[model samples]
Target: MQQQAISTEQSSPLTLSVALQVVSAIAVGAALLFVVGFAPMDVAHNAAHDARHSFAFPCH
Candidate 1:
């Protein structure tokens, strides 16, 4: 006998909300990284500068 896996179903509304939240979080994180990788002369600025200088990426 073969066993089948059971899956839990989420309502469409709940699924959409969760998906939106995940996408929003990803966007926020990307924005933060862009700032950190492009902003010059600040706290996160160091990360940006290093990413450009040591990593051979343009900071300008």
Candidate 2:
């Protein structure tokens, strides 16, 4: 019986462009949260604080 040949090509699990897109999205989201969540006004601060508590994130 003849044996089948095995392929030697190596493939990446993730492409570079996709990885960059993911990183960029995360960075933008973090920046947005930082800017809006840390506003000086009491209303904005309270809203962000309450949101953190709702998500079980420690603010203190």
Candidate 3:
């Protein structure tokens, strides 16, 4: 019985298309952060607080 070897192809350098995708993600994240002035800690705190009380508390 003969075994066949698999051929592996080498990839090219990172192109402009990939770079533009990364830039778009960064730009969107920056825009979102600019609109929301709170830090991640504050965001997490608020989310946690809401999750803990949103279902049971009417006075909040």
Find the candidate with the highest lDDT and give its number.
1
- Clash pairs detected, candidate 2: none
Clashes of 1: 0
- A best-first ranking of the candidates according to their lDDT comes to 1, 2, 3
When superposed on Cα atoms, how far off is each prediction in RMSD? Answer: 9.9, 13.8, 14.5
Alpha-carbon TM-score of each model against the true structure: 0.52, 0.43, 0.39
Per-residue lDDT of candidate 1, residues 1-60 (tens digit): 011111124345666656766676787789876776766667766656756677665655
lDDT of each: 0.59, 0.58, 0.46
What's the true lDDT of residue 54 in model 1?
72
Sort the candidates on TM-score, descending order. 1, 2, 3
Candidate closest to the true structure, highest TM-score: 1
Positional deviation of 39 in candidate 2, in angstroms? 4.6
What are the clash counts of all predictions, listed in order? 0, 0, 0
* Superposed model 3: Cα runs more than 4 Å off: 1-14, 38-60
Measured with C-alpha atoms, the lDDT of residue 5 in candidate 2 is 14
lDDT of 2 by residue, 17-59 (tens): 4565567678778988775565566776677887766766545
